[model samples]
Target chain A: MRWVDLVKVEARIAPLKAARPGDGRGSQSARVSVTETGGQLSRSSTGGVARLVAGGVWTIATADRLEPSIDEAVNTLRGTVEIDLGSIVQIDTAGAWLITRLERELSARGVSVSLVSASENARRLLEALAPAERDVPPPPETIGVVQELLEAVGRTMVRSWEDLKSGLGILGGVVRGLSIGLRHPRRMRFTSIIFHMEQTGLRAVPIIALMSFLIGAIIAQQSAYQLAYFGADIFVVDLVGILVLRELGVLLTAIMVAGRSGSAFTAEIGSMKMREEIDALSVIGLDPLHVLILPRLIALILVLPLLTFIADVCALAGGGMMSWAYLGLPPDTFITRLRDAVALNTLFVGLIKAPFMALIIGIVAAAEGLRVAGSAESLGTHTTSSVVKSIFMVIVVDGIFAMYFAAVRY
Target chain B: MRGAGKNPEEVIRGRGITVGFGDRLILDNLDIDVYRGEILGVVGASGTGKSVLLRTILGLQPMRAGEVEVLGVPYSDAAPAARSAVDRRLGVLFQHGALFSSLTVLQNVQVPMREHLRLSPRLMDELARLKIELVGLAPDAADKMPSELSGGMIKRAGLARALALDPDIVFLDEPTSGLDPIGAADFDALIETLRDTLGLTVFMVTHDLDSLYTACDRIAVLGDRRVLIEGTMGDMMAFNHPWVQQYFRGTRARRLGA
Candidate 1:
């Protein structure tokens, strides 16, 4: 009984020896004559015997149609049988399936099947039947170009609709607030008056003072040199005063406040909104509009006008310094000329534009701020928008005021 | 919890509460009544409307269809002054505590008292310190900012702030979330003690098992679009509902020491 335990086999199977036809070796068969009593087997040929005893021989040949001979040989093995699977050079699934069934049936019958030698293809075929072996399924298909395009289009449409809806909702709230303000005139008017004082008159001081001081220094430097050339240096006092009172004073103050306070209002309210504090207020039975917006609006309005007045004084002082250096005009002489160059109407025109610009800044910044949602990311976006919108609106309002003042003068 | 001896009916009653977000129904015709000095826990998976329920009742979120009566005050029908008067009767510990980052712990705790009552600075400071002490934080912790405290410490500070007003009804959202097990257990003990000592009607939303077992007088299991079952721990343990059974059973599939 030539028994082999291929089930626990670990060693790599050596290659097969192919016998050429008509080389005194049988064409149809290669036989090993075993001396059963000695428990040793030898090949028929002298060369085959030497190689068999020296290196253990195996065969390789195709099974063209020898099913009967193969079945008969496998059945005659009563104890155990080892096949030189290296001989199986060509075998279809038909042959492979037969081998598998035979292995299972013979093992159950206490007849073990072993591989003395196995070809690469035969081992692969046999291993495929092992329980854990499986084919790796192909990857998921790529999304088609048309499908990708359609999905992108769908997402864009959804986003656009969401943006439009949010815009409409905010616009509706603004319109409602305005309508109520109109219907309740006395309340709105009083609020407007107070806010004008705070936002426009009062809060615009520091920036106005700083800017006017810088402007005056620049004007003094430029005029002093120019006046030296003309030898009419003293007239620059009138020049500085006229420019300060007529234009730069109010315009500079308005632009400064628009950037400073406007961005501040937006970021503050926007952050409050992002934290759901606004909603928290409403939930507690407090009107968020009255509590948050009204006070801020009033503060800006009340401050702007006062700031414009301060800005005028500072700009003139700056101009006076320039005049004193260039035109040999003292601070007293500069003030006297300033008093003569522009009258009450110039101050009134500048102050009038201050409140309008203040209103534009307040409304635009507060509106943009209240629109903030989500996290800190949205906070940055709303703050930027608030500053930009406030500045733009302030400039536009200033243009309208300029137009009206121009028309009146004409 | 001073009203510990009072009957359960006198606690908090919510009638026909229905809230919606635009067209999506968040809560529909929901009614919850928490007994005096009882810890009522609201439990559910994420997005099952647990937080919404807490908000609507706390008056931090609006009620589209129902009335919330806290203590004896009819909060829904109350005027602004009356509503504020009602708000004065309750305290809220938000999920994130929502402590003012600008104010110190003591100032945060003293806010409601300063706004609604006139107390001497000394008295206010004493009260704030007392509340902080009750929450097991150092008296010196009162001067620190909310950002300076750990997660558990922030929650304790928030609890102190909530307890400042000596509110009868306290609403806490996920009080033990983000805390370690031991810290969470300590928080549970603190909550249980607060319920006992203050005689507060506690309405809490949480997913913590220890809190449900140790603190809650009764548990409401919110699932399948509604509260499928609500009962004491003993009753909940015996609940035959598939979700409840599976939840209590947990994953017993793995063999130990295999």
Candidate 2:
């Protein structure tokens, strides 16, 4: 059956080739044919006169194949040229532009060009396109790889400077908004803050708890496996407790919140900016920082520490379960070890980083959002940057906290 | 509805085109035919489904009953290659100028040409520039993004893209809605000139009475989920329907004398 289909396909294609005899591969002078009514061009020179006959459906579809022939005619044809348009069945702007271009190029070369026997429709199009025969400006030049790289580096530096300025501006605006809310407690948008809190915090509990629990179990199993070699299997509980309380709990929770709530903040505010709603708010004498960013920022700052506490507890529970199941240490023994290993300060250090992380996330997201231009693409770009910049800042702030605690010997 | 005599070739034929969103019927059993080489202006009161009918004929919206034949092909039911062949021969300019926001006007015009034809980049540039100039946009406006263009310039840029392929038919949705009077008049003149020079069949959904009076060869008024009247300006004036009477003989339309 396959062999029969192949034979039939060949039988179909054989006549197409025969019917289109002008079809040739990469011939500069050869006249190419497309469809049955595709554009056809032929050149003949006799006694210092070149007579070119153009025929068939001369539109944009055939312009690609017809263009090279016209160029070849322009470059090679010398002296007077007569272009016969009698046989041309149809001509659109593209075709007319080609003929007009050929005429202009020949005239520029001191060769008298005459368009003869053009049909009424063809004549109208040619006359219409006569004024449109101006030189097209060349496309923008592409720079070399080295120059592009250097330019990108320079752009990144400038962009970073702008980001810093905008970040500080947002922080100041947030402070001003907070002061306004403090002075007029009635102006505080408590409903909006609660809405954002519900959206970003309450809805996020299950996913955040599940993620932290899995991390805690994995860490316990790995640590117990390593500690057992030295007959120090009981030390895994101390490791899990201190790590979850001081670093992993807050860091993982902040990163997750940045991915979740931070991107949402950027997208929401960015779409408002894109639609000129931000400008509308400003014109209405309402500071967008107060009306829009304040509620979201307050909610994030209030929620991050609470979420971190939840994450810590879930992680500790996961570690206790893992120890009991894998290392044969019971939950009470694990709890006793955790209490002995980690102090109140250890938990405080982690909880203290949460608000600062929240502030960074909120500021970056809001700043990026407000920077969105009048395009959906710009909104997407800013939303993505908001997530990336907040995550990077979260890690950097965590590292700084770690260094500060180490330096003070806290 | 068929014409009285002298049968003209129908470039677009919509038969019993029933379109609705959920249970709300916008166009019910509507039939419309647009002849070749004619500017057919479709007008109606707001929410009468003028744009819906246009979308139906273009196959952008699904019709619950009947079919549309464009350029003698029922493209919705046609094979993929056949559909694209018909699609290449048709051009559409949406109400909002619908230029790709990320691309410049020049690149937007080149998009259709690039997809269908295998022209050289230089030829594409020149053709695109010619189109831009033909639509009366400033040469420098070619490099500006859609966001940077004014409302009138965006419409012109969109028209340039629509005419990019030298399509057999051009469908324009509210082409002059956002333009100033002078710009709207210029656009109407441009559309008329394009039709004359390129022999293009234009299906224009417009509210501009000036365009209907001066540029459109025939007008189709949509009403009550179907076409109420489809005829010349003279026939429109004589039609006794209340909406038709108000539309053609309204105060705004009365400024242009019969």
Candidate 3:
């Protein structure tokens, strides 16, 4: 009846187990035969004393598997429960925890549970983990939905305001850098400007040309279908030529450049910011605006008009070819009608908008890039916002130019 | 884990594990075993294939030879079902805090549970929140993406996801590397508490000497294309191996009270 003596009994059984040549596992004899190695709880009654026997590896490895069974057994127990660990060869913190949880459960049922013949290691591990387990703090509370929405709105407003300020700062710095370079022309980085030109301009040529060509062909074809009913089919050449030379040519090219070069600039600047490369450049006494942004902006400004011209020529050729195919007019006849309908000043007006639009796209992209924070998510958000903002700015600039030319009758 | 069968002392056993890329042999005929319910720290100089060894045991990297057994099952030879079942019982913590940048902290912790269990959304939410709190993260962190969390917070959130499944073995890769001294000590203590409370067997790859002395129950050194030595801290200090001697008795080691 002295359950405290079970540890002594286990110690005593060790030599006896050794005496039996095949008893290497030592004193594994079970009272109720719970055979599972993961864990098993069995009921036993010795001389009217109700008891529970725990056997097998009662550790975290077996926690998920053994937890339900432990719960079930704890539920079935009544009154005072004496838990025997004499058969438990291995027990971990989870196993010890389960035993403790069972004890608590039993106590709740008005039944006191006592552990018997537990290993010293299990006792120590349980003791180490027990004190801290009760202090597992509750999760932090979330604010109300209304507060969260307000907070989000406030954060976005603050971020956008900061973005706007940074954009102005960068634009002012670019202007100052441009003025400084203008005064000291020999000191300016011509090679860097040319490289950026190749990147933002020269390289954009083929795609722009092909895209413009397709647009012109589509416009001429679509115009021919409607105009044939009015017997103004030959005027398809005039419409395609004027639209391509004046508005569609530069507007489409600017949009494409905004998509391509603007995004690339943002990503490049954003990554540089993320890596602290921009900071490193400053530490070395280099002005990033003068060294980096100026070249890109200038190159974009220089090449956009050239790209627009290329788009206009390709589009006119496409319109001429489509006029011959769809309106049954010869190529020479289409060319002659195009020349008569479009004026030189219209071409000049569209070309005049290109540099300003390019400037907007480059400045917005570079500014967003410079604004990028340390996270990959920040880089991505800035890149997307950069393209969107610049494309918007480009269209606005084009609209202003259109108004300026219309009011002047130029 | 590729090594087969569990010895009385072994929970993770790797025998003659040979890993190489192209012609360069990284770990050649390596033999090591992680005892059950102990924090076994695997230490080596950088580029010594310590991570590679851990990867090989987890079956992330291919082994040219040798086998490993984890939780008493052969990892490589087991059927996909059996392997994944074993995988469910294990978790890995990366050193660089590679939490998915897009997902909220709660969603990250729920990833494994959602994949393996068809628990209801409310239940999953409760369980995921419990895990985040268990790792000592703020509850508000559950709604925040990985990008929003600070460096230490990211690691703790990553730990929450690793412990979501209540795994038996959690492999920690330099858990305390980037943390400040106090933060590192707190992290080490957390690892110990989880081990004691959960009965987890930890296999950690680390260069932190404080972790080696305070957290790890046993230390295994990887060098010369295999496990150079495996023993307690005392054994490491007493060993005659040149690199081990320099590592354990170095100036940095002295600062760690080694």
In angstroms, give how far residue A147 of model 2 lies from its true place: 3.0
Instruction: Itemize residue pairs with steric clashes in candidate 3.
Output: B2-B67, B2-B68, B3-B67, B3-B68, B3-B69
Candidate 2 chain A weakest lDDT stretch, 10 residues:
A18-27
CA lDDT of every candidate: 0.64, 0.86, 0.78
Mark the regions of model 1 whose C-alpha exceeds 4 Å error after superposition.
Answer: A1-410, B1-7, B252-258
Which stretches of candidate 3 lie above 4 Å from their native place?
Answer: A1-163, A184-195, A275-292, A370-375, B1-9, B15-25, B28-31, B62-69, B72-80, B102-107, B118-150, B232-242, B249-251, B254-258
- Clashing residue pairs in candidate 2 are none
- Per-model root-mean-square deviation over C-alphas: 28.3, 6.0, 8.4
Task: Give the per-residue lDDT digits (tens) of candidate 1, residues A65-131.
Answer: 2333345444554465554454343332223434554465556667755655654544554453333
* Candidate 3 residue lDDT tens string, A49-153: 688887755644345555676778777878778989877665654466678777777887888778898766566655654443333336578899999999999
* Model 1 DockQ, alpha carbons vs. true complex: 0.01
Ranking of candidates on lDDT, top first: 2, 3, 1
Best by the TM-score measure: 2
* CA RMSD (A), model 2: 6.0
Ranking by TM-score: 2, 3, 1
Q: lDDT by residue for model 3 over B132-193, one digit each (tens)?
A: 76678776778897867888898899898888766768999889888999999999999887
Local accuracy of candidate 2 as per-residue lDDT tens digits, A1-410: 11111122111121222111111111122111222346778888878888999877567766777888988998988879999987776567888899999999988889899999997778888898888846777768999999999999999999999999999998999998899889999999999999999999999999999999988999999999999999999999989998999999999999999999999999999999988899999999998999999999999999999999999999998998999989999888888888899999999999999999999999999999999987778988999999999999999999999999999977
TM-score of each: 0.42, 0.92, 0.74
Q: TM-score of chain B, per candidate?
A: 0.91, 0.96, 0.95
